[model samples]
Target chain A: MILPGDLSKIRSLEEVFLIRFRLDKKSKVPLLLVVFGVMLILFAILNIVLGSVRISLHDLVRVLLRQGENAVYDKVVWDIRLPRTLAAILGGAALAVSGLLLQIFFRNPIVDPYVLGVSSGATLIVAILMLTGVVLEMGTIPPYLLSVGAFAGALAVVILIVAVSGRVKQVVTLLVIGLMIGYVCGAGTTILEALAEKENLHNFVLWTMGSFSGFGWEQVSVLAVAGGVLLVIAYLLCKPLNALLLGEDYARSMGVNIKSLRVVLVLIASTLTALVTAFAGPVAFIGLAAPHIARLTLGTSDNRALIPATILLGAVITNFCDLLARILFAPVELPISAISSLIGAPIVIVLLMKRRTSL
Target chain B: MNVMQTKELSVGYDGRTVVADINLEALKGQFICLLGPNGSGKSTILRCLAGLLAPLHGSVFLKDNLLYQMDPGDLSRTMAVVLTERLSPGLITVFEITAMGRYPYTDFFGHLSREDEEKTWEALRLVGARDLAERYFNELSDGERQKVLIARALVQEPEVIILDEPTTYLDVKHRLEVMEILRELSRKKGITVILSLHEIDIALKSCEIVLLVKNGKILASGPPEEILSEEMVAEVYGIESAHFSSCLGGIEMSNSGGAQVFVLAGAGSGAPVYRLLNKYGFSIITGVIHENDIDYYVGRALGGAVVGEQPFEEISLSNIDQAASLGRQAEYIVDAGYPIGSLNRRNVELARRLMAQDKVIYSLRSRQEFEALYGVDGNKPVYCPNLGALAQRLSRRKK
Candidate 1:
């Protein structure tokens, strides 16, 4: 919180931080539009090139095309780095958008999409599957099925909070209820995990680690469909989402169909979040931090600007962190979730400190 | 027949009803004010009519369409509102906030059409916030924020606009500015303007129709001068002895003789008294204050002479001499009740001096105090429920 030169004027740092802003409102979207697009591509390339095997760009592209079949190179690129990189990019952006929508709908800065016990649900199912020695075939229930389960679980938590209201409707209470639900689900998952057999426990540990190595193009296609559908629905409800920022009554007064919008937004955000978490194992803090970064950069709640900004920021940050995670440990690559928490925490703090004095 | 009317509209929150039998209306291009006490259900009725709240008993008809039955898009095109709602107050520019008012007409992409953009700009100009269009909405002062909120409501492109406490946090200039903006909007766009206000003076000064809401219903409605007659005000507010008169104290002192009369008051205790005393020509005088009181500053701002005692350490014979001189010229001596029981002799002496003067009308605790000062009969002291009582007393004294 750096105060400007004069307190009497009480001006915004948006101007003093003039390097970031422009006055020509219509001239937006052109310059940063191209820059963000290129940034995404660069990070994606880096995520692929920096992993353990030194596959050349040509070899990687050839392997992606199913042409280059040198066993070691194909395994490194096809079976290891390529799917992981794609998962990082898609999962990052999807969760980021989900967080953005949830924050806007609940009108709470701390309202992460996964906070509604979503990841807990996925973990519970995976734990159950492990404890029971239910060996899911390689492609039987891809991350897509997990994501669908998580989406339903997230929706269930929301319904629970809505129904459980002897308490106030303030943001703090909502956050506490979400956290309580998460803890309860986590406890259930833990009980199942404690009773699991050794061989089954080993597989569950790998799933919980959230690797990109398990997925391929078929899984990517499902991610694409879920993310695309959710993003489209989120975009359509932008006005109502923004209106809800002023409170439900005000939004109602403005002719926003709140009940329908709430149902649609919750469904879409939950699905988007569930998809990403399923594929990447609750990529820590990306959903929470990416939207704040987008808001800090773009400075508006109009979802048109916020959604695109969050998407771009999500891609760049997640891919960049994933690149670091693989290269830092090199041959014995670290979990992408660990890298996300490391970078995402500090950025979220800066955003909170700056906006604390206001709603 | 009013353009926007309610037939026994009973509005409430959750399962509990607040305003039950509210029958009210506002003609096209008219400014209607709903005046009531804190829990009198003004906002509930406003919300129900705005289609934000459901009616428990009856329905709201907006230009002949049942408000609840209309499609949100269609209802939004014909309705807009300003409320005392706390928002994110994000880093949005005033232009962006006003632009959101056009959301009903904007497509899914939220791109403002040429017509929408023009209306937003015009709305800003109308509220005199055109210069602040580029300013961040969250960073503005309360007055400026109120204006921006009003501007946002105006750009909703509605046939009727409802505001809840439009002047709640504004200064004198902004309060008048908000009222004037609503007035001008009613005239220019033929939009029915309805707002609830606690500022009785502001309602008297501006609104064409004053609806008195109390006990879960509208007790009266019509022009401010007619419907807001002395008796109606008294009944609605539970105020004692409301009256309207041109002459002060039965004497025609001047063309404007009977000004609102404010008695010398204590810290914030005079707020109600000041308000009740307030009329167009009435002047304010805050005094008999110790140096370090919050209301002493308020009284100072109210711009009246004060019979202020000096700081205790500095209260030599010189300060007492100064106090005594002013006390002689003082017309009304309302006991400020400083440091009750008079443990300090200075307050007792000051009280003695005020009660001693025949021309100075003072209200003390008892007839003994009155008889000890001006030597009047030892009758019971009149009970002052609020500022209005003090004003009527001062007005009577002016005769």
Candidate 2:
């Protein structure tokens, strides 16, 4: 409701206005923060409320408040859906921020966690552990150990890339090396899968098709805590990462400790990729697409805004994809990667078409 | 007081030394240009100065401290580098790109304070790119992009700025624009500037001190007026001495070996004949131009032997004597139309005398016009209305 005086003030404010949706466009960063924050919360709730179980909004609130009447509904909601939803949130953000870091580090728009072979390396180690009867003591092994093994394998590839990065000055050379490493690790995983026992094959195959199902509270806690820690480290690196966008020599001239910064970027990116690969297989394209989405929406590559925006966008996208994976098939869940690629690939194509100058 | 200095520095890549023993010092607010042929280690020396590459031996000093040993943050605060590498950061605005210069000054997370933002805008304004703040960096023209890059360096608030071939791919207008901005920055801001340039003319015009690099060493370093001589340019660039004139600013051309042609021209009319003669492989001698005449500069720079008079003076007997000797020695003569002023009216007598001789006289003027100007009747010379026709007639004479 605007009076005559208020209408005149609004007309005066139009001079500085650019795009609509913000009252004061000069303070658009804070406005974007608030808008994205609200959207993230809304999407997170929408993800938890709508699944195969068809929990009503009222029951969703009751379950969230821990005062629900139905014990079976509570078990399904709290035990199954909550952890899975949380895994989607944490895992999505970890991969997204990791992708953003690699993109900045390599100065390539198409790079992501899998481009560096982290996902393939983690998959290979997990395949070896699952298929070789190494983890089957009395026919059962904890998921936590599987995550640890996946992390070690991803870290190994990361360390290898870091060792070679010093010798290679060209960014394309480093990316090609990373791709070859991915190929070798992928071939090893394929060979191991072909030789696995008949009963163990199903589990190994399921792990290969990335999903947010089967996450327990313990696994969720580890993903959350680890992703949270790495997210903070990535946030702290926003300044240097922005500097690096100008290229290494310029970054160095701007007082960025490029050598140490490269080490930290690799470690953080690899750890984030490992966390997702260990728990949910190799989730595809979220890391690559989420940052692009944030950049397009917010109109910036300055990582101070881009990092948080990417994290939130990544979490929202993965959660939405996981929800689709769960409900689209009803009783049986589809692989999250298939749905993500189905949706994420087109966004990349559209981005390429829209921003042809960048391409 | 010296702001930057290097002591016996050796620079190269991966164990091979490209440049060695580069001892030099630069005073504050000095604009120095490194002039060299391609791959003459100009970039290597600049890289060493910018601290991007460690020197193979010796050291660079920024004021009192060793450059390589200084804390990177402190060094970066004092000096910034504008590299030749093109930035392709996607979707980034010029304001954001320019603000990156505040990296060393900004707090940990790189959030810009009010003062930092002001400095960023001020830096953009300094490069006269305030309007480009919202424009994308990649979308800018080459000249505008270079300006934004320099603005990024300016926001670092450095006392010294090093640029490596900053005007490599720009057109004439844009090249001059960039040089003007750098000169203004050095003059008004008192920022010491060191840049590498391929155009020695621009370097001679703009740089206070010139470092001529060749064969992996500093060949010479001094003020441009003193050290940029015809012999020095010939030795450094491996061109003939006649091709370069430092007083006229490094104008050069290849010597065309053909017949000798004497051009009777003055008051800005002989420049084209001299250039055409040089281009068509004819040895040229241009005559009786005043010292202040524009033709004299072009003629001399293109390796033409010119008979000269004092500025605003009459054509003297000595000048006519030199012109007659050169005209008698020539196989061909071009009568370039000069105005019949009192000071240079004797040039008509020189042309009339050359025409009376057996020399093949090519006139840009018509038969009646040449006769009227030189006070000769019915002596029709070969007429060439343009330089092209003149070149064609001369080339036919060569056969």
Clash numbers, per candidate? 2, 2
For model 2, residues A213-298, the per-residue Cα lDDT tens digits are 86889889988898899999999888888899899999999888888888788889988998888878888889988988888776
Every model's TM-score on chain B: 0.63, 0.91
> Which residue runs of candidate 1 sit more than 4 Å off their true CA positions?
A1-20, A61-69, A132-180, A193-206, A351-359, B227-235, B238-399
Candidate 2 residue pairs in clash (backbone atoms < 3 Å): B256-B281, B258-B281
Candidate 2 positional error at A236, Å: 1.7
Residue-by-residue lDDT tens digits, candidate 1, A1-359? 54566653455554545324546444565455567779999888877766556778898788778899788887777666777777777878888988987787777777787776777776776665546545455434445555555545655665665554323435456567667788988998788778886776776776676665556777677788878777777777777777777777777777777766665666677777777666666677788889887776555666777777788888788888888777897777677778888888888778767763353
TM-score of chain A of each: 0.81, 0.88
Whole-model Cα lDDT of every candidate shown, in order: 0.70, 0.85
RMSD of each: 11.6, 5.6
lDDT of 2 at A349: 80
Best candidate, TM-score: 2
TM-score per candidate: 0.75, 0.90
